[model samples]
Target: FAAAQLQADKNDVDTRLSQVAETTAAMMDDLKVRPALAEVIKQLIAAGNVVAYLPQDRAPRVYRIDQFVLKRDNYGQFTDIIIQEKVWPSTLPEAVRTALGVKLDPNTDEKQIDVYTVVEQRDGKVTHWQEIEGKEVPGSKSDPIPTDQAGWLAPRWTVVPGSDYGRSHVTEYLGDLLSMDDNYKAITQFAAIASRVVTVVNPNSSLDVAELAAAESGDYIYGEPDTIQTLGLNKSQDFAVIKDVTATIEARVKEAFLVANYRDAERVTAEEIRSQSEELENGLGGTFSVLASELQQPIAARYLYVAAQRKLIPAIPEGIRPKIVTGLAALGRAAEVNRLRTFAADAIQILTPQVFASLVNAPAFLSRLGNEHGVSSLETLLKTEDQMAQEQQQAMAQQAMQAATPAIAEAAIGAATQDPNQGT
Candidate 1:
């Protein structure tokens, strides 16, 4: 019976996951498309790791740090992470000091300390936490850290992971570019060297070393008339070849980073632009998949967990764990969207009006269609059956009133025409 109950709970969670998949994907889509978020991800890819802190009151904030350590368990889950940061003595709040077991010294007001904030998780829950001062062992415990939060977890702090090998697009191509850059610099230096004019002094002329040095500084040196001839080295024809090579290298780097080349959008048709965009999206498929698994989903889950603990969002449902549905993956499946549209259109065409009406609410269906197409006007233009029925009734009432007006007028005329003489 216990096993059966566990299996039933698992089934319920799976059903809920399926139900919220699209909604989750849309949320992920919105997040991934943000310019700031993309920039952060690019930095993460370049730097190998980035620190992100989720405050209970606001959106998650990312910090670029030069020093940090991360350790993962056998299952490739982060088990221990430490962030070392320097804080000014004055800026350290009393509560923070208490958490770190720092006693205030009025005399050391201007000192800076290296605080190592460590968070350790075991079996998917944070189990150990320490904020040490100057890399010392655990100190005396003071008052319980004052927090409105109920969980043992500290504030939402996370280390956003990058490639496991610490390799990034920038790092991959940077070495080659560095050599190219050096070659350019060398060419400039050589060009400068070639530009130097050699002044040939006559062997017969008596020369003072100081005067000759001064003469070299001036435009013309004292020499026999013919000996003053300037010898200019011909400019190398290899510059064009070098330029082409550098440009090719730059293009390759951009390709690796999935950076788009500048194009004349006004001249290109929408279809062409979309085709290029789809191609680029496909090219980025592997990178996005890795990011979704390693960074995006984990950060989102951590955000949700902290938000739930802080009462910022509704408490998570029992026996249910939310999973992130990657928007990139969903968007890639354009065939699925096309299939859904085709199926719905065919079903609508084949079904009788009565059957369709009984099966689905027309206004609701229209509203959903509008939402799927991102068309706000469609939803606004659609009216419910009740609203349509009320409008029809109003039109009929006006028509009946117009029809009765002429009859009423004729009756009045007949009464007037019927003289009292008829009665007499």
Candidate 2:
């Protein structure tokens, strides 16, 4: 009973968290945050650093590295950031435009309004708002929110221990990309030159420049035989060398990016699959840690905050905190499941079924097992006390009929064979 109650409480918490996640996701969709997040990731891989933040509305917005500058505190945390945005007057609400006193001119390109928003730690608390044309804007003004509730999430590929910013695979392999670009340019120029025909002529030779210019394929060049040869640059060897080098660099980049050739086979073994999975998880362990901390944690906290504010979910107890399950934490859960299953197997192996049933608390054991396996409504599957009692009664009645069957059949036969004649 205690075990069942504990599991019930856990399920309730899980249910609330699930509701919060679903609500937050809906808001993200309504705010068009998914596309912005995609762009943030694209920019993160293309460049090195990117930023995403939720501004209480139309969030989370993404900022490329160039669009924002950030500062870190002594604890290597982002304490301040200023993001620049170019907003057209039309995109802004009419009230905001009127408030900003924005004017439009027919001659200029719907001249963009430069908006700068700074979120920074002030007096040990963070505050944020936007500045338009040197004037502060209404809404999103200075109110201190919890750091996690402040709605900032910055995911980097990898970073130095104390650096506020991070570097990426693209940045690491930049040299190869540059070389590929330069080699491609060279090849294009060479191909262009090779495709053209430039005729050489001696000053002493009388050549019709106009005729040559107008000549088609196989047309005669009326000049001294030695002075009319076409110039050509045979760059096949150099082209081959450049291509070989480029191929080498391309292969290296592909391998680093895990786009290398596959380990093809008719069938893959479980061990091999497990090995590959472990390799990927290990290689990306550091990156996943950063995301779990920066991206997942903040999002989870923000979702809870939003849920509470909008009354989408009931007020959560102060004692309960949402945990982002990833990396080692996720593994711990998997390990727990395995250990539970193994324990059950071992108990059954070491003891007979009757012995096991006699010694163990079957209801509690089954409930815990079902909970770990994520199977809900376990009580429905388990037999009720009344049901068990009824089944036991039916089983005993059936056994009694079976045990008396032979004696009853023998008695009937004896009476049938002798009783009629003797009584007459």
Over 360-405, each residue of candidate 1 has an lDDT whose tens digit, in order, gives 6455455544445544234246774568999999999999999999
Model 2 alpha-carbon drift over 4 Å, by segment: 1-34, 55-59, 105-109, 122-125, 180-248, 325-424
Model 1 / residue 100 / CA error / Å: 7.4
Residue pairs clashing in model 2 are none
Model 1 C-alpha RMSD vs. true structure (Å) is 9.9
Per-residue error (Å), model 2, residue 52: 1.3
lDDT of model 1, residue 72: 63
TM per model?
Answer: 0.59, 0.65
Please write out the lDDT profile of model 2 over residues 1-424, one tens digit for every residue: 9986776576555544545556666766787777777786677677767778876665577888888988876665688899999988888877777787887677878877799989886555678899898888867487897777877766677766778888885888899889988988988988998999888777677887677789899987667677677888977997999989987888777656656344688987866755655665676677677767767777767767776777766666778777767653366445567777778779888997678779876755665565555554555777766788899999999999999999999998998887566857
